[model samples]
Target: MTSTPAFPPLKTYLTIIACALLLGGCSSGDEPASEPPRVALVEPLQPAEPQPEALRLSGVVQSVTTTQLSFEVAGRIERILIDEGTRIRRGQPLAELDRVDYQLQLSEAEARLRQLQADLARKRTLLAEGILAPAAIEALEANTVAARVARDSARRDLERSTLSAPFDGVVARRLVEPNMVVAVGTPVFEMQDNRHIEVSVDLPEIAALSIPLGPELKAEGQLVIADVSLPLRYKEHSTQPREGARTYRLVLQGEPPEDYNLLPGMAMRVSVQRPPRPQASQDQFRLPLSALQADSDGGHYIWQAADGRARRLAVELQEVEGDQALIRGDGLQAQLPIIVAGGSKLHEEQPIKVQERN
Candidate 1:
């Protein structure tokens, strides 16, 4: 009876109960949300792979020896056997000149020799018999010697009328035609042997002296188009590459592939495998030149990967090559393949996705 008197109506009681229940529900403890599986939002921190050590050298391609063949005597070119770019062997005839004059001179000398020999013989017999003086015998002997000398001269002249290859090589220039008149010392053929081509390139002074002689330093030279790598023998180094420049000249010997067919005066790129300079203690890490970034404290650092996360590593730059920078420091291992080509836009601790290069 007392509870009924206090409550204004059952509906009001119900409304109050509902409000209390709603408050209780709002204040009650909430069920904890399941974490997003602690997924490592990071790129794979794969160890850097062993990098290929190479020296990139660029210069002009040239031959060790280029033969410029010339005519020893003046005459008209009668028969030209070989054309330009023809491969010639040693002592092979290249051209021939008119030898009728030389043959006539040779014939005249031979006749004179016979006459002189006859005169000498007659004079000797007369002197022996006391009919002629010894002076006559001596004069006949001198005449015979002079005739022999003339014949020898004619023989040399005949030989000079023909052009022969001195060594095996490919003909580079054929400057004369079959009927062209050539003079003494006139260059009619230029030849070169491509079996072993010399690649002469300049290196910085520090790099030149550091390179040792012998077979240990042959560069693995490869042609870009052909993509064939060949060994380059260290032939020579210039004492003074150039004044005021810390550089030296290096000569490498090797034969390019048949498809490449390198020519003299042609430019090519050479890949030189440069191990860490001798006695250099620190390991070398080659990265893109653009990978360097200066911090506010003026410290140099590069983007390093750690635990599938991006990290900033303090690094010291040692040298710089085209599109590459050599750095040294910890947190970098040779087994890890660093970001070389694309590493410009990256931040510390930021997630990264490695895009495979095609």
Candidate 2:
């Protein structure tokens, strides 16, 4: 058998119940602290209508004209007045062949011509006096004419013995040395005209088709050489693909600055400026630079505040100026609120509170 415990007084019971209520109320009221994410917001600027996008492609700078010089007649190279890297003016003698043999041939031809002329003169006099036949005088006159033709031919050969510069250029290579016998049309020197240069670039088939052909594109673009930007003149393009099925060649001509020496085979950039097509989506926007964030996979993203949550949108970054970025992405709207500051700490669809800035 167990004895029953005595009941407590009403005041004590009330005090105990009150204490229990207070503990239960305190336990129910306790909660974890939560603060809304503070983010700096900026309104994206509406991209200007028909904004021009610059296309940059790399190319090699080369001379517009390159030539190989040679003589017209076979002879021994008597003298080479210039060496490699020699700057030459038009009509400047670059190399010379031995002219002694040519000179001798010219002299012999001249002597033959004089003898034939004298004989013809005597025959003419005799024919006029009826001492020589007409046929004999005609034969002597023909011989004199043939001799004169030979003399003229010999003179031309003599003049052709010297090789001269056809234009202002720098000598790239000297193929023959003094005393070296060279045949007719043998390359003696290699020279380049550097006053004007061309940039050679290979573009994909699609890009090539978009560009205007010769002389029409000169006003559309310029080339970047080191720190200088020079106007480009459209030269030519290849119809056939090179290296790959989609690559085609484009040649653009430009003059080098007088103060800067632009040599052939130098690498440089070509920039083409043109307005966007009329039917584009017009979704590209310029936002503050701080709004951009790079993902670990090398993709760019921007945070936009929508429905009180942060939305991360992938973007194709076009160009970045001091504090503004030209970006293109899907679902981009004009004047959308972008999180410029505190975007690095954001997550997808996270709660966000936009902080207005002055």
Model 2 C-alpha lDDT per residue in residues 1-358, reported as the tens digit of each score? 9999999889999999999998997889877667676555656545724545556777888887899999999999989999898889999999899999999999999999999988888888888999987877777788889999999999999999989999998899988888999999999999999878888987776677666666667422333545766878787888888854678888888878887777887887777654465534466678878889999998999888888888888998877766888789888878778888778888888887777545
What are the Cα lDDT values of the candidates?
Answer: 0.72, 0.81
How many clashes in each structure? 12, 0
lDDT of 1 at 177: 89
Off by over 4 Å in 2: 1-49, 219-225, 279-358
Off by over 4 Å in 1: 1-53, 213-216, 243-246, 256-260, 273-358
Worst 10-residue lDDT window for candidate 2 reads 217-226
C-alpha root-mean-square deviation, each candidate = 9.9, 11.6
Per-residue lDDT of candidate 1, residues 86-153 (tens digit): 87788999999988888898999999999989888877888889998877677778889999999999
